[model samples]
Each structure stands twice: as structure tokens, then as C-alpha cells.
Target: MTSFNSKKSLRRVSFISLSFLFISSLFIQGCKTGTKGIESGSNTTLEASINQGRNVFENSCAACHSFERDGIGPNLAGLTRHLSTEEIIDFISNPKKVIDSGNKRAVNLQKKYKSVMPSYSMLGKEKLASLVSFIHTYKDVPKPVDINEEGILEDPIPHQIEKSNFVVNLEFSFQIPASNEELPNTRITKLWGQPNTNEIYVCDINGKLYRVKNNKPEVYMDVQALMPNFKQRSGWATGFGSFAFHPDFENNGLLYTTHTEPIGTKNADYTLPEGLSGQLQWIVQEWKTDNPKGKTFKGSNRELFRIDMATQAHGMQNIDFNPTAQKGDKDYGKLYIGIGDGGAVQMKFPEVANGKHSPWGSILRIDPTGTNSANGMYGIPSDNPFVNITGEKVAKEVYANGFRNPHRFSWTNTGKMISANIGQHNIEAVYVIKPGANHGWPTREGTFGINTQESVRKIYKLTEEEMKDGVTYPTLEYDHDEGNAVCGGFVYTGSNIPSLTGMYIFGDILKGKLYYADESQMEAGRAIDFKEMRIALDGKETTLLEMTNNGHAKLRIGKDANGDIYLFSMNDGKVYQLVSEK
Candidate 1:
């Protein structure tokens, strides 16, 4: 039995040797073919080889070694001069063999690095050559700018966009009641800009829309006229809400606004309610522009859509028409709306505690031109994720899901979608949307586990493989401990602020702090590491600027036609431009 075992072992060794030989032959062939693509001129060949080598190094070597800085191993800035390309390739492809063969360099490198450079025997010979080429060309020259300046700014221009600047200088402010007694319950929940009139629209918790122009405030619309008992029935006093103008508002005069409407009334003693009582319902209404060219809207209004709330508190609503979207055109026109999961405060009401309703938490992409159905108010887009899926009663307008209070979202100048989700008690998040991503909200908050029905249903616990299959995760996120509420802002494609260009500007509702996150922070496949962000104010003494008694805080940041940034305060009823204190 011992003799038979020995024979079998010998046969196994022989087979392995033969397999290695075959692979080696294939590797050599791949390398030779790859060399053919290089130019014959020595300089050209060297440069081409170096470029290829850099790609290989970044993908394979840089993870282990840094050319000038320490990574997993020592810097290798001049490694090529110490080892020939052939020797380097052999050592990389079979480090153990070279070390055992008594090659001093390999032996020393292994000992000093304290980690064996793993063999890349499976890599084609061409790839190995490219990698060696990259090593040969590496230099230890200092970068022209401070290495720390890497993501701070990309553009060299110093001026903001010209046309955008014009809008920036057109200043205006809103007037709040001088005495708290006059408007004891007033809360400015949101503010909107009318691109056509260049005027600002403000919505107060008291159910009034005020128009501000030339630093004066006038009533734009009063809810009591439309809904007789708005103050008692509308839950606008509790959450984030917004208004939007149709893309063709200049000509069509159609407007849409989102507010919390009461679902029904209930007896103070009822045990179990039939419909939501004092619950917030997301209502989208349309009103004519009264005077398309005027500062105020005065006309008959119609309700477009009213989504019943799962809970009242966390229901945040934001609306915007795609700036790049063209009207009268079928495929391009769209109204993007964000809905928050019913209030993040768990167990505020018995129904929410029982899990019978869905909290307002999702990004809804809809077409407003079609019939009202589960799919949307408009004809469903053929390209919508669920449009072609068979055997499911899914809503096509649901572009993505699993968001908790997506208070704000915007499309980049290049048309990429980004959003900020207000977390429950633990975290706040920012996500970039791909076609049909599931953001994993109540089930998972900011990439961490949370105990919710969605978590129990296996909706939030996605394995890495499942996440890979679909489900785009957030590009950025932060803990509530850092900032209580996240306010989403725009990407800096504006030309004026050189330092702010390419950065994303965002703020916190409670902290009143402003932040600038670099574009790289928006990259996919990585968790946003926010330690590198630049805060606009030092943490010690600066307080976030609050709006005057208008019950409005600095609610939203706006950009003019020129790309300059402006802060709109709901409490102060004022707009402030971000200019150089210099």
C-alpha cells in the first residue's frame, strides 16, 4: 500500500510539471504577440510599454507597493535599474522560485517586504511585459501641486458663468411677521424658484405660498381659499415639501406643488382607524400661472395626484423637472419626485407600530402627461425598469426604492442623478441612481443593518454578489451624530467659483453647517469617506445662519444662470449670496 501511494504521488507531481510547462508556453506566446503592438523605435516602444506597464501596475502592483510612498511594501521608484525586464517578469510571475534559486534581490525584497509577492503565473506574458514596462518608466519626481490638493479643484478658470452671474445679482428677500405673536404657528417648510419670472416662491406651515420680489413679500396663494380648513387639515407644519413649475411654464402656465393633506377625521376615542387620521397625504396639485409673465399666480387649481401617507412625520416631498428634459417631446420630459419613508420617529402612531402601511420612502420617476394609474400619471416610459418585466404588477414609475426621506435630489449638468436621504436615528445618506437600484433603506441604513420589516423580509440584507447583480448603493453617507439632517445640493459645474467647481455643496438642516465634497466622493463602488471634506465654518464658534422669524431655516441652496451659489433662509425670509469675503 505504501509503494502504491508513492507511485500515485509521483504521477501527480509529473502532471503538475507538465501543466506548468504548457501554461508557460502560452504565456510566452501572449507576450511575444503583445510586443508586436509596440512601435519598433526604441523611445516609442519604451513609452508604449511603460503605459501598458502602468495599467498593470495600478491593477496589480500598486495595491502592494507605492512608487514613492509606503503602501503594503516599500517604494519601488527605481526598481527597473536594479532588475532587467525579463528578471522582473520572472520574479513577479514566480517569486518563490526566484527566491529559492538564491537571487539576492528577490530574497532581500521578500524579507524586507515581509510578504511574498504573489505569483501571477495565470497572467498572460503580454500583461507581465506591460507591467515591467511601467516599472521601468516610473520616476520619483514631486508633483507640481501639493499632493493634498488632488481633489480640491480641477478647473483653472476664476470666473463664474456669465449668464448665471446675471441671475445671481438679481437679489430679493421675504418678510416675516415682526412679532412671533402675529404668526405663532408659522413654519416655512420650503422655497422654490420660478425660472420664468425670476421670482421666489415660499411655502409656510400655515398653508400659504408667498411670492418674494425686490425684497418684498406678498401672498401668492392661500390654502384656505382652496381647502377651507387647511390649517387644521394640512400636515404641512411637520415636514419637508416643495413646488415645481412645468418646463413650459413660460407658455403653458402650469404649476405643481407637493404638500401634506389630511386623509380623514377620526373621533378622539376611536381604537382602530379606518383611514389615516391626522396623517399626511402627499398631494400634487396643478394651478394655472394666473399671469404667465406676472409675479403671482391667481387661478383655479386642480389636484393632480394624492398619495396616501404610510405615516405622517417622515413624509418629505421634493419636485423638479429635468432641466435637460424637453416638453412636447415624449421620451425626454419627466418630473422627478422624492418621497420619504413615513416619519423616521418609530412608533409615533399605532398603525406605524403595526407595520400595516408603507412609510414614504422612495424615489418616484413619473411622466405627468399620461393617465393616472399605478404606473404613473403619464404614459409609462418604455425604458422604465418595470415596463418590460413580465409577470409582475410593479409600478414602472418606481425608478428605484429603499430610501428613507429622500428630502432632495438633483440631476447633474451631465444628467447624473444624486439624492440625499435623511436617516432615522443613526445615519444620513446620499445615493447616485442607476436605472433600477434598490437603496436598502429601513432594512439597511447607510450600509449598516437596521431592524425593520424590510430587513426581516430579506429586502435589505443583500449579499455582495446580489449587490453586484443590481442595487446601486449610496455614493456618500454620514452619521446623524455628524449632522442631524442632510440637505442635498448641486454639483459645481458653475464656472465662477474655481475652488467649488466639481465639488458638491450640501448642508445640514439642524446643524446649519455647509460642506463641500469633492467629485470623487460621488464615485460608485466605494463608501464615501467624508473625513476629507472642507467645512465652510470652523467648528468652534460659527453658528449656522438661521432664517428670520419666518419659521424658515436656510432651507435650500440655489444656483443662478451663472452657476453662483445662493443660500435661501426660510426663517429669516432672506437669500444670501456666497461671495469672496476677500
Candidate 2:
């Protein structure tokens, strides 16, 4: 037996010795390409290790062992009071060694159980230590008692849990005429309009922007011609991605568009790093519409910023200015850019010089009008989460991080910024983006564990304390069985649909499954259960199969100047407005 102080010293020494062994295991096991950022135990304290241990226990041991009562194995709640931490760790790591050596207590226990405890030596020393430490922390505390079977909720809204009966109908607005043989590439990816304007600006993934007036679409900008190599590897997910007209578009004629461009001298404002390997770069260009009342762009433009990306798959996807933010507000006139992780699983922390951040896998906020950065092109807001820090782990331009692919984000009139994060495998997440908060990625997908050596989708549970530090969980999440991808929509503030006025309207991209939930619940820091809104056409309830023709309709939720919402299909090229069922 050893004293607590002596064991603490020994634990430190063991942690130091475990580093070389852990790195060697990566080589021996042939490290998975995307799982390189799993937390290493170098700086872990006993408390932190115990948290890791709790995760391991839930994943591997909880099924067989119980803390209160014997399940398939002996009770583990107070095992520390009966056995020393060293003995428990040793026995769990190599039960066979302890039992086969004829150790009297180990042999007697094995005989009584009539089952051999499998050696968990492969859990690695660090994890194993963590697991034991977690178990050791449970001394005499009683297991928590749940009074209600459904569990107590904070500010629970009973109506939100009930299914919604709102019925929506799809009215064919117009198709985004295909420029080529591709079925979906030239279809409308986004439909946007500004206040006091009757015209709607629609853009496609093939580098084309069109102005829709009187249900007719006319070419507004030929983005494909602006880049020579865009057509080489472009599809429905690339090309001229999104566009945003400034809040004061009528006064300044300022507009912005994000496009995928080749990384070399074609547009010479930026260049690829000497050894950078990505073919295309995601860039934002500021354009002055020669005539604000005219139908087409006459080409007065300047480059705002560019990120040389490796893959065009998740390259810069969407951008928008905060519409509700006013003149004296902190967020006024700031453009929010949604950047993906460039088809990679993680991002580079301790951001590099020049404040690109991951530039990938982040939601960036920048002042397009100010010229305070080193490049003197765009300004980093003074209050941005990572604004003034230099040579530190944070990025000056990063507003919030830990996003895999934030396809779309919108602000409500109440100032809640909601983002839909496309998930990797099991689940899709919708988060309320907060400054300096991390919506877990690579490490987590939705509420599930996303990075594990054994499986990418294995669940990793976090403790309450860990969640409060820097990690932020989703406001709503659903498994893959519910929908494939989440299409972010706005919080309904329109008057036409009485039932949906205060509800958030969002849908699935692949299935066209529409859902709405009360925003007040989430705004108050409580998660609300979502209910799928059934779509009815021609006096009959229908599924996506009936509405979309096939099951492949790509659905997008759009908003107009009046804050009225509509749904668009990239597959069939139709737009539908939500109305009261007649």
C-alpha cells in the first residue's frame, strides 16, 4: 500500500513514461489519417483522467458492471474503498496475469464468478489509468434518484413536445434553367432578396447568378467566365456558391459573391503558397453594381479575401450580413462567412500567422468596410472572439470554431444566430452559435462521439464540467434515420402563417422533411423537441416521394424581404410558400 502523495508522484512518473509508449502505439496500430487529434495524456491531471475514464467505462464496462448493483459483474461503485487504486488498475489491465499466477484473492474471485475477466490491456495505459481513476473517485455518494420517468426539464413547454399539425403546400415558382446537361448543377442553390426590393437574386453552383423578376430569371452575372478552371471539377456543390446584397444596397450599390476560383495568376490579387497543393481557392469578391436598377452587372469588382483550399467539396459555401443588427450594434454591417473544413476532418489549432484561422471549419465575422488588418483589405472586429491575440492558438478573424460544414446560418430578429452543421455519419446538428464557444467537430458529431480509434462514430460522452469549459452542445439533433442533411432556415416572424409565426422553420436537404420548433425554448437555453410538419397537396397528405417525384429532392429553405419563408427544391426546380391549409 502507498500513501496518497507517493501515489501522486508515481502517477506523474508513469504519465511521463507512457508518452513514448503511446506514440509507438500509433505507429504499431497504423494511425488512422483523420483521427490524429485525439487528446494526448501528456498534460492530463487526475481529475481530467477520471473524466476520460468515465467515457471508457460507459463504452466498455457499464454494460457488464454496475455502480449500485451487480449486473453481469461485481458492483464497481465503491471498489476503491475495498481495493487500492494500483491493485484495481493492475487487475483490470491484465486479469489473466493476476489470476493465472495463483494469487489467492484473484483465483477465488475468478472461481466465484465462473467467468474469466478478459484482459483490457489494449485500452492503453493512459486510458486505463483514467478509467481506474474515475472508478476510484466514487466513494460513498448515493446514485442519483430520478423522480420522474421522463426526467425533469427546465421551463418545459408541453405544446412543443406534441406533434405539429401545420400543413404546407408546394407551389411551382420557376426553375433555375440548366445551362448544360447536368440535372442539378445549374439549379438554384440559394434564393435571396433584400428589403424594399421586388427582385429576387438566385445563384447556382455552376457560377451563374440570375435576377428573377415577374417569375422570369435573367443572367445577372456570369461567374463561370470569371474563373477559367471552375468547370474542370465543378458540380452542384461548387462554382459560384452564394451571394449577398449589402443591407444598404440601394444607396451604395455594394454586393458580394463567393466563388471557387483557380489558385494562381488568373485573378492576381492572391496566390497559392509555394508548396500548397489544393487546386482551387474559395474567394469572396466585392462588386459595385454599375446600375442598382439595371438587370446585369457591368464588372466593377475587387477581391476581399481568399483561402486556398485543398478540396472544393466543402470549400466556402455560404455568406450573409446580419440583417437585424443596426447602426450602433456590435454586429452591424459585419459579414458572416460559413467555411467548411476543406474535406478534412479537423483544423489546425494555434492558428498560423496572418490570422487565416482554420479559415476552414469556422464561422468568420469580418468588417468588409474597415481596412485595419495587415492586408488592409478587411477589418477584424475589435470584439470578435479571437480579435487582438497574435501568435496564440486563436485566430483574429474567427468568430466561432469547431464546425465541420456549417452549410447555412441565419440570425433571428431577436438576435439568436442559428446554424445547421452537416454531420459526418450518425447525426446532424443544429446549434445556436455563440462567440468563443466550440461546437464539437472531429471530436463529436451532434451529441455522439465522432472520433474513436475503433470507430469514427463511437459515442464519447463528456462530463458536465467539461461541457461548460469551452464545448457547446447542439440545441437540436437527430440521428441519420431522421434525415441525411440539415437545411438551415430562419425563425418565422411573418404574419401569414399564424401557427408558424414564432417557430423556427428548417428542413432536410435530401428528404425534404420540414420541421418547426419554438425558438423561445432554445433562446432561453433549453432544448426543444422538434416535430415534423406534414406537407399536404391537393387535399391529401403526402410523403417526399409524392412531392419530389423521386426520393432525391434537394430541399432548401429560403426567406424574402418580408421575413416570409419559402421552400425550394434543387431537384425539381420549384419554390413553395407556406400558407394556412384551406
Candidate 3:
């Protein structure tokens, strides 16, 4: 087990050896040194270049690179309109060289988007020029006048996340193995506990399943090695998404997992409508282990279903079997899948996830043991919210609808369901979920009206008529003033930290700031207050931001077998256990 501390000197290395290989490969490929092939003003050449460039961008760059909107990568729509092809090529060929020379644009881009700009040098001049040519055709649209400048909350929460009396002292546990040397070292999304089996599993989006023993991580399963078509490279949320062990895993060896594959790898159960392109497919699968008591996964796996996603931003996360449910309870053994809008609305396909009929933006409940679904691979719960809906083609598996990036959801002992949603440009939210609930997205963001047709960054106070439109608003929310993304956490019901009981702990993914709300006080139709919880490392005060290998903290919250919260920093691949005392 390795302890974590501030480490900046080592991490500043420029993309390490990967950038070197990218440059070396480009040098060997050889090309016109000064952008000779780019015919920026020729309409005839633009038409001819579109096919190759479009195909390349759609397949290779669509995962993170976008000309439309900025997420992980900067918007490239107006990229070439301001800069010359020579300057673009020079920067793409070597961003570090340009940045080192004090180019303000290159320096700013690096600081803003982090490692989203890996060396494009490996694409060589032909592909690079073609990619640039495709981007050049789409000029940036002129900005629209603010429709609701006065209505928007410049800082939604108004005040900073206040420090509470509670101090969450952490003890550093083992670091999850670095799957790759990329910026996000390990996409450690979930740390799940199976009570029956008394085992805790940590899932890395990079395809590894780790079983924690004492303070160390041991590989229990390797999805990348098992599934030939499995990939995490195409998107940040690609790879082994989430896993769920059967409530009776001690008696039954069943485990469910979600992963992503390149589009067209297999026919999908959920696909985009006519003319709209779906970039990737998310696969939900089940595995039955040969030995139920084994330390490693030796199993036979089968697919339950697959769905096409518009972009990789938000598709599937944190499948669950209600931990609080008993054997005879209605929720027992039923798997709940937190599905996002798949960037459909942001990708200009808003209608795809607009209602109950579409599975894109929904929380689905199903029985994995029975085969009654349309695909005959899984069973949709008969009592699900939409199963009996008439006069409409509804996805019966939908328990709730109208969420953009429904990252994680969990149930408390009081039977209240809570969820955290990743916002677009304005609010990061938490909602008390109920069946058939519409936690508004793409339209209403955290009690504010968002115009999907216009810039999503703009939000207006809801009109009187829009307020009564039956959309359930967020129970707790924060604006981008303090952080970037929300990493939903669980209500700490564990015994180790009695003071943390009923305190729903969560954090900002980008800023690594921690906050919590009184889960016991959270209720539907009513907003609750949340506050920042301070952190200490071995009796010394510290912030998760400073503890990361790089400054950026892709923070994820996890629960151990005892229900204790564990903090995962994808930046450093380290796991820190939150305790009442150091």
C-alpha cells in the first residue's frame, strides 16, 4: 500500500513516452512541412475531402473530440476560422513545442482541457490535414443574445460549500494499479460491497475488476482479456462500466457488468432513430462463476442487452440490487440500471431521450433471472412504472425518466431513493428519486430552465406555466462556480463513523471538493442544504486536489463491505479510506 501526498514535479512530464512515439511516428510518415495540401478556399476540394475526414473524425475523434460543444475536449467548430492551417498543423504536430514557445492559445487550451489534447502527430499529415479540412467547413455560429441573463444564477449555491463541524479524516490505502499512463490513470468508478459474500469489488473503466483484501487490491477479473471487442480507448466512460453481484452471491455465482464497444460490433437492443449517428454501444452482460467461493473470476458470460449511444459522455453507470431490501421484499434481486441521455440532447438529438418510450434517459428495473423481455434475455419487472402504460410504445423497464447524466443512485434504510446528476454547463444536482419521476434534463436543469436549442450554458428562472409542467426539480444542487462534475455518493450508514450516519457524502469530480447533505432531512418537492466536509491526511490537513498525482482530481466515491465511504482519485489511482479518527 502506498501513501499519497502532493506530487507535482513528476506529473508535469508531457504525456510521457506516448507523445514521443506520436511525434516519432509522424516524423517517419513524412509530409509537406508547411500545409501545402490544405485547400481551405477551394469548394471542389472541400467536397472531395469531406468523406475521408468525416469518416475519420466520426470513428477516431468522436469519442472526446467534438466540433460542436466542449466537454472533455475543446470545441473545434470554429478552430480553423481564426488560425492558419500552418499554425494548426504545427500545434497538432507538437502542442508542447508551441506551448513551450509561449503561444497563449496553446498554453490556455492545455490548462483548460487537461490531457484531452493528446498528440495528433500519430495521425500523420494526410489524416491530420483531412481532419482539419473537415473541421474547417463548419464555421462557428454567431452568439445568440442572452434570453435569461437576469434569471440565471451566476453562482447557484450563492455561498461556497461551507465547512462543517465534521472532519473526515482519511487513511491512505493501496493505489489501484495503473491500467495505462493516460491522465486518468484508473477509471475507478465504483467500489461495491456484497454483504452475503463479504467481498468488496472495485471497477475500473479500463476493464479490470479488483477485489480488495485487507489494504491491497487483487485482480479478480479482467474484462479486456476476456472480451475481444471490449475497449476503453474510444471514450472516457467506455470499458467496464459497473458491476452488480447477486444478493445471494455466496449461494449463487451471478455477477452483472456493463461495458462499451465500438459501434457495429454487434446489433444493439437500443439504437438511435433514422439518420442520427450513434457513436458507441454499451453492453450489459451477466457472468456465472464456476466456483462460487473462488478468489478469481472463472466464469461463463452472456449478454443481456446492448444500446447505442450518441456520445460517450453518459450512457450507463452503477447497476444495483437494493442493499436494504430483504429476501421477500419487492426490490430484492431486481437490478436497477442508471442510464443517461447518452449525450442525445447535446448531440442535437433531443427527442431520442425525451420521454418514457426511449431507454436513453431512464432508470431501468429488471429481473435478470427471468427471460420475459422483448429480447428474451432478461425480464422486465411486471410492476414497473411503464409496464402497463397504454396507447404508447414505452420502455417498460423504465422506473424513472428525464435525466441527462444519471451517474449514481442508491436507496436508504428509510426507503428514500437519492441520485446525483452530472450537469451540462450550469448545475450539478442531487434528487430524491421516485418511480415514474421526471427529474428534468435538457430542459430544466436544477430548477432553472435550459434552452436546449440555444446554448445549454444559458439558464432562465422557470416561467409560471413551465413550473407546473410536472418536472421534479433537484433536491440539492450547486453551480459550476465551485466545481465541474458531481460524483454521487452514498448515505453513510456504516458503524465506523457514527457521526457520518445519514450524511450523504459526495464530491465534485473535477475540483475534488467534498460536500454532504443531511440525507435524513432530504425530501421530494423540497430542496435541502449541503455543506463542505474538511479532510485530513494522517492528522495533517489536506485537500484531495493536492493529494493527486496531477492537479485534476477525477474523484469517485465508493463504499466498503462495512458501508464505510472510500475515496477514489482517478488522477493518482489511489484509494483513501474515510475514518472518524486518523
lDDT (CA) per prediction: 0.51, 0.62, 0.72
Candidate 3 residue lDDT tens string, 1-582 = 011122222111001111211111122112334334466657887777766666555544323334455333434454544455665666667666756776444444443333323455556777666766766666673222222355445555567667777577898877889876555667788887767555678988888999987767899999988999996742257789999998887778899999988888988887777555666789889999999888899979999988887666678976988888889888889999988987667655667776677887888899999798888999988879888889967788888888888898887877788888888767889999888988887788888887777655567777778888898888889886677679898888787777778889889887788998898788875887888888899788889878883435779998866778889877667888888843
State which candidate has the highest lDDT.
3
When 1 and 3 are scored with TM-score, the better candidate is 3
Query: How does residue 136 of candidate 2 score in lDDT?
Result: 60
TM-score of each: 0.59, 0.68, 0.82
Task: Tell me the RMSD of model 3 versus the true structure.
Answer: 9.4
Quality of model 1 by C-alpha lDDT:
0.51
Q: Arrange candidates, best lDDT first.
A: 3, 2, 1
Summarize candidate 2's per-residue lDDT along 1-582 as a digit string, tens digits. Answer: 000011111110011111011111111112233211123355566558778876665434312233443222333454444444455556656666656777654544343233343345556777876765676655553332221213212112223223466676645566777754533434577888657676877887767888887778888988778755553242325677789988878878888988876655344323322333454677788998878877888858887887765344556778999888877888888889988765433221112112234456788888899898656788889999877667744446778777777898988888889998876544667888888667777566665554332333234455666555445778877654566578888888777777787888888776677888788776422456888887766667775546766434578888877777777766566666665553
User: Candidate 3, residue 437: CA error in Å?
Assistant: 0.7
Model 2 TM-score, 2 decimals = 0.68
In angstroms, give how far residue 116 of model 3 lies from its true place.
Answer: 12
